[model samples]
Target: MEPRWLSQDEQESWLPFAAMLIKLPAALDAQLQRDADITHFEYLVLARLSMIRDRTLRMSELASVVSASLSRLSHVVKRLEQRGWVRRAPCPENGRFTNAILTEAGWEKVVATAPGHVEEVRRLVVDALSESELRQLREISSRVLQRIDPDAGTW
Candidate 1:
């Protein structure tokens, strides 16, 4: 069968979106690295932990929350551990699973880093969009994410 293809209009729309997928992360990561000495993914792991109860999450659950593989998360967690930002141990409730717990230092780092990150995000995205456009952007992203992974909800 002949393949379905994006028409001219669809191609025009897709081009910018595809470029954004690459550029946005790089820009965010660059800001985090410069200001916080952390990569964007590291910030995400810490931020996610900061929001949870006890600042603790099972390793697998943390991976899911961060949209990372367990192996990749483990490596990042290892780096965090070395910086005294995070620690891993057997889950008290279930020794078969490990838990990632944010340390006091990790919490402090998140608190300190968040302002600069938020400012950068606001400068780059939030402040650029009108209220209606912001809502439309959210709706459009949700639809695309649903198509990409039906089980994974929007971030």
Candidate 2:
């Protein structure tokens, strides 16, 4: 079957979106690296772990939450472990499972870094949009995410 080419308007919109996909992660990583000595992905993992009950989450659950493969998460977790930021323990309920727990030091690091990260987010994305535009952007993004991953589970 022949593919339908994008219209000019779609092309223009997609170009910026594609560029953003490529650039945003790099930019975010750079900022985190400068301020926290961590990659954006590592910060994300740490941040997610921080939010979970008991400041811990099962490895598989963490992988799913971060949309990362087990192997990928393992490597990242290993690095975090080295930094004294996280530790892995055998899950109490299931010996076969492991849980990633954010350490006190890790929590402190995240707490210290969060303000800078939030400022970066505001400066880079939020501040660029008007109040109405921000709302519309959130609605659009939520709809697109739901369509892309219908069974993505809870927010």
Candidate 3:
């Protein structure tokens, strides 16, 4: 079956959204690299670890939460390990699995970087939207995400 082309209105709306999807991550990555000496994905991985109990999470779980492939996560984890920001140890309950544990230095680094990251996020996104528009955008985004990944609800 042939795919239906977008209508003019759809194209107009999608253009900016598509541009945002491409540009926003790049901008965030650039800011993080400059300010934190880490890529945005690394920040995300660390941030996710920060949020977990004991500042530790299984590799697979971390990969899922960060939307990263295991191999990609492994490489990033290795980098973090080299920096003494993260450590890997055999899971206590399951020896076959490994857990990523955030070090004190990692926690401190993320804590220091968070305010700047939050400021950047606000500057780039939140501050531009009205309260009602932000709510509406959240709802729309949730629906779109659900449609894109049915299993995403587990997160």
State the C-alpha lDDT per candidate.
0.96, 0.93, 0.94
Model 1: ten consecutive residues of lowest lDDT? 146-155
Q: Give lDDT: candidate 2, residue 93.
A: 83
Off by over 4 Å in 1: none
Best by lDDT: 1
TM-score of predicted structure 3: 0.95
Q: On lDDT, who's better, 1 or 3?
A: 1
- Candidate 1 lDDT, tens digit per residue, 72-118? 99999999999999999998788899999999999999999999999
TM-score of 1: 0.94
> How many pairs of residues collide in each model?
0, 0, 0
Off by over 4 Å in 3: 1-3
Model 2 clash number: 0
User: What tens digits encode model 3's per-residue C-alpha lDDT throughout 1-155?
Assistant: 99999999999999999999999999999999999899999999999999989999999999998999999999999999999989999998989899999999999989998899999999999999999999999999999999999888774
Candidate 2 clashing pairs, residues 3+ apart or interchain: none
Ranking by TM-score: 3, 1, 2
